[model samples]
Structures are given as structure tokens and as C-alpha cells.
Target: MIDGVRAILIGDATLTGLVSTKIYPVSAPQKINPPLIVLIRKDADPNKCKTESGGVGRLDEIDFTVLIMSLSYGECETISERIRFLLDGFQGISNSKDLDIEYETEFDSYSEQAKLYVKNATYTAWYKT
Candidate 1:
């Protein structure tokens, strides 16, 4: 099934240590699959508009989203091996439940992270713990 990872993930602490992600199709068989992690950060302003009729402004969370994709077929045959292979060389993120992330801007916490590794074809979803 196409699993959905819904999280207002703070940019930086994503798919690092104990946190894992997996993505699979709905028609596919069920397995002990991890969730697929995708972090979408909103770099724009929180709100810049005014109310029109209702006067009830549409409030939005001044934060970004953490997307965790699902698993697919064929990969299951070698999921274990694949997971191991991908972990190679990559440093292990701290096992802290808190997002041990640091920002560079005055409000860096609001800025999320999105990194794609072509060599591994796997995406990294970063967020605070």
C-alpha cells in the first residue's frame, strides 16, 4: 500500500538513526516494511493574505511536512541487503528521540531539509527527532 508519512517534521532530523521509512503499493503483499520518508519544507512566508467574506482567516502551520514513502516490489527480495548497502559509509545519526538538528539562520528551525542521493537512488527525509 502507498503508505503516507504525515509529520510536521522540523527540518534537519529526518531518516537518520532509529527513524526509518518504507514505501509500497496497496496491491502488494504486506511485510514488515519501514515507512518511506519524504520531508517537504515551506520556505515561504506563513501568511500574507487577509480574510474576504467569512473574516475567518485560513491559518496554516508555520512549518513543513515530512513525507515517508512506501516500499515496492522486487526490492523486498533484497530489502535486507539493500538496507545494509545503503547504510554503508553513511554516518549514524544520533539515536536521540529529539531532533538534534542545528540551523544556520536566525530562524533556521523553520527551514527544512531535502537531499537526494543519485548513487543510491534513495532519498533522505530529514527532521528534528
Candidate 2:
């Protein structure tokens, strides 16, 4: 599921041009990079509601935190804005699977250790299993 989401983000020309294949699923490497994108699964909850046929459905509420790290806050903000434009309210097929974005939030932060600006974008995605 996370791979599908990553594919969508990586496939976007605008986003790819900025970060290339620097998007990480869980966390970035130990070596670290100045400008990169990180995808973190914050939480997930299963939908208890059954299907119309009285069978279980593959519905889940998955929350993801997408981080855009850059040397400066302005650059981070710019990349984050492009990411938001590409992903906010997106509904489509990724890796031959259907996914829907339910909600999203974007914010800013600082990485004291790395001394980099972090733009955090959180997304709530609904996946139909």
C-alpha cells in the first residue's frame, strides 16, 4: 500500500524533478541527504463495517507523514507545495491498486540534528483491499 502511494508521488513529473528517487518509505539513510522526501506511516485503523454482501471489506484508514527536507525553509516550503498540489484529494490507481485520499495537512518544522528545514505533510488515505 505504501509502495503504491510512493509510486504515485515518484511518477509525478513535478515531484520527481525535485527529489528524483530520493523518496524513502520508512526513513532516510544514515548518510543523509540535504534535499529528500520521506514517507512515514503514522497509523492505520481497520474499518469494522462489513461489505454489502455481509462479508468483510478491505477498507482501512491509513495515515502517512510525508517529509520534505531541505537546507532552507523556503526551499522546503516550495517542494512541499508542489507535493501538496500533486497529492491532495487524489483518487486513482497506483501500482494497479485503487486508493483514495480522505484528508491531508501540511506543516513546517526544523531538524536540529541535521540543521535542515522540514516540511511535513500528513495524509489520510483510504485503501480498498
lDDT of each: 0.29, 0.83
Counted clashes in each candidate structure:
23, 0
- TM, every model: 0.21, 0.88
lDDT of 1: 0.29
| Local distance difference test, candidate 2 | 0.83
**Which 10-residue span in candidate 1 carries the lowest summed lDDT?**
102-111
Q: lDDT at 105 for candidate 1? A: 18
> For candidate 1, lDDT tens digit of each residue in 1-129?
002122212222333332332322222134443434333444423333345564544323222333232343332223323333443233324334212122221111111232211112222323221
TM-score leader: 2
Q: Which regions of candidate 1 deviate over 4 angstroms?
A: 1-35, 54-129
Candidate 1's error at 18, in angstroms?
Answer: 21
lDDT tens readout by residue for model 2, 101-124: 744778788979889898888898
